[model samples]
Target: MASPQKTSRKAAGTRAAIRRARPASGRAHSGDAGDDIGLDALVGHAGYAVRRFQLWIFQDFIKTLATVDIRPTQYAVKNVIGANPGLSQMAVAKRLGIERARLVHLLDSLEERDFVSRIPSTIDRRSHALHLTTRGKAALAQFKRLAAEHERHVAEKIGKANREQLLRILACFT
Candidate 1:
């Protein structure tokens, strides 16, 4: 076995190397030895910054709605269904960019929760039209209130103006 003193020295050296590798903000910098290893390099990269921001926003949304047990995608699907009743499953899937098979499973879960209903479509007997249940309408209202609170948290973090600007810029991509 290695001596405790030797282990301590090894650990200390490892910690020091980590400190050197990380920025003052304590986030790990990703780059090769010759590259600038800090936020300066990361902030200049749009995709990386957007991904990091997306993760932060998603985590905040999940935490804020933990009590209601709604994820971001679920909330989005619910909102669309609530707003447009009798939309076909395919319509919802295409609108939200969810895969058809995946949407079927998602709809199944929502139906099991008594939050959504799938009725036989009059125009296309093979397809199911989506609708929110009475319970779902009530739950959606609660979800909206919670989502607004989450938005407020986001606004506080990035400022309302920046949030609005971010939305506008992101809208271009979608």
Candidate 2:
């Protein structure tokens, strides 16, 4: 992985943009005290490192999902429905860190594709309970396989121990 972008200080209370450079040898180099570490120190700022890593992982996800005709959010909603049949739309939205209103559009698209169904919530007439259709179940299985491949690729890039530690530390922020 590349080092974090250059880090600078514009003011006492603000941070400057982080910048990174690649060596001619094609190796990643994090900044050290002797080097102009600035804000670009990959080891110095966890957030910067994580942001770059997230973009890397997302790119991998996009590549792996290209053949599926479904967005990551759509797959996640379906996965949630598969795991918790009859879950309320609001609950799915909350679990996915998305707005309930946004979820409605996603649900509509899925329903149109016959991947899922929305039934009236037994607990609340005004609410909806989500369920995956047979097609959606099959799609989820395929997605799981793709996800496993994605994870394996990432693990290979960042060692398994580092990957596990990274996930554990990231969960703390959430």
Candidate 3:
């Protein structure tokens, strides 16, 4: 059995250790040694910043698309196909920055879902033209509405002014 005074001292020491471990400013400071877990150059890196923003937006995207059951990439593909009926598969792939091989597989999935159809091009026998089905049009409409809401939410989060500036900066790279 320990004395009350020794127990009090031990409790006091534990509190002091916790206070030392956590800095007053909230973020933990690396003591004399260098093991600070802080955003050093990651905050300054453009790719890292974009990836962070993408992750943030994608979380919201997942929630918004849950009812619709379509991913952002799928929505984009449907949008392009809906807008540009008779567009070549290669053209869609190029515009989306996707490879032809990958786009073919993606198209296969959409076709299986009956969202899109690939017709042999009259002008180019080697190419297949893309078209969106009635179902795809409905999904694209829902996606556009959800996407607009997402855009507004993101703008509110980052501030409209900052969002515009950030968009301009991002556009320069693209």
Report, for every candidate in turn, its global Cα lDDT versus the true structure: 0.88, 0.79, 0.82
Give one digit per residue, the lDDT tens place, for model 3 in 83-152.
8999998899888898889888888989998899988999999988899988878768888998888889
Residue 47 shift from truth in candidate 3, angstroms: 1.5
Per-residue lDDT for 51-151 in model 2, tens only? 88889988888788788876778878988899999999999999889898899999999999889999988889999889998988998899889888888
Candidate with best TM-score: 1
RMSD for each of the candidates: 13.0, 9.7, 13.2
Badly placed stretches (over 4 Å) of model 1 are: 1-41
Q: Which candidate is the best by lDDT?
A: 1
TM-score of each predicted structure versus truth:
0.77, 0.73, 0.74
Note the residue pairs that clash in candidate 1.
Answer: none
Candidate 2 vs candidate 3: which has greater TM-score? 3
Clashes of 1: 0
